[model samples]
Target: MPVVLSLNIASKTIPVDYTRTGVTGIDKRPVDGPLEVRPPGKKGSSGSGVAGDTIGDLTAHGGDYQAVYGYAREDLDYWQGELGLDLRNGQFGENLTTQGIDHTHARIGEQWRVGTATLEVSAARIPCRTFAEFLGQRGWVKRFTQVARPGAYFRVLEAGRFAPGDEITVLRRPDHDVTVELFFRALTTEAELLPRLLEAGDSVPPQVIELVHKRSVIELDS
Candidate 1:
């Protein structure tokens, strides 16, 4: 059964030895007991989906479409062996470290009822400079993109509390061929796949849909 292996949150942005942007809430820590979860709201500057959590750069971080981030523990375990290190839960800055779910294969707009909250898969985490800095790996962006196991972000539908060990019940999956890994590839290395993103319909973020359409037109013109 799919379940949340760990719940993580950062109360404030903190300084880091690496990265110029100070690394922000990338250093999330696991918490015990139940914690409130909700939409980051319409404001770009909202804290994370978890109550009391904070995001440093609102311009790139918090938003309604990216209210929560989730990564599968199995995927992290694979990276642990590849990196030859013991990676802890929340190390990837995921709000929920899940088990038994395949992040890469997760369907866009898939709904999961966790505890009392309902969340729908919205997008995949895009590797950024800060994320590379957090990992302290050279050519991290390229490497991660090639590996292409970017975790999924979720939009909160029903606000409620959840805890580590809570079961995640799949409520529904949208009738789309777009998976998280596919979406990430389309956004990054594979422009040819951009047209396929349209199959996702409204499940794809509106801004992203617009961008893809623009790219499609440019490709046709070129």
Candidate 2:
């Protein structure tokens, strides 16, 4: 009934001067560390809570590698087929590759143990234009965000350190079924999805909240 192998992190986005670009970038660094989640108040380059969009999470925030799940070698092929993706590239910046646990299926209020810290799958990653440039597509960024399934946004329940090959055990999953993929769609463009997702703000992280709010306002004014 459960399938989660491990979560890992890295000291930097890449080896000294190692730039991550294209689908092959996932193979650049294969290391993991204790999971860490960022809250609204967490420091950002602007001294405010900044949430990186899905693709940006791996590159924009300048984060090395954070939370990730493990799965079979072919799991990626499965997702590419399931999502109709190219499968040759990865948009998430996580240094840790995934295996069994379906990141797309992760939902709000779900709790899991990552290394020594506990995390709740609260929201989905929101892709930004910066990611489009990284992905080498002019429209891929917006297209990816619309497709959602942008991986899970984990809210850190506790702070700690982790490394590659560390096992992540899911403690419990709340009684919600809406997935991170659906959530991204609803919030970014569903227009009506923001209110419903915000209604459960306690379970949603500020980063996700801010993105939804920003999109709604942008659309409203447009």
Return the top candidate by lDDT. 1
The deviation in Å at residue 219 for candidate 2 is 12
Residues 73-141 of candidate 2: C-alpha lDDT, one tens digit per residue? 345565466557664323334433455567777767677665565666666656655445444566766
State each candidate's clash count. Answer: 0, 21
> What's model 2's overall lDDT?
0.50
Tens-digit lDDT string for candidate 1 (174-206)? 777799999999899987887888887776777
Residue 112 accuracy (lDDT) in model 1? 91
For model 1, where is the 10-residue window of minimal lDDT?
A: 15-24
lDDT of each: 0.86, 0.50
Local error of candidate 2 at residue 62 (angstroms): 8.5
For model 2, the stretches where C-alpha displacement exceeds 4 angstroms are 1-28, 32-91, 207-222
**Candidate 1 CA-lDDT value:** 0.86
TM-score of each: 0.93, 0.61
Clashes of 2: 21
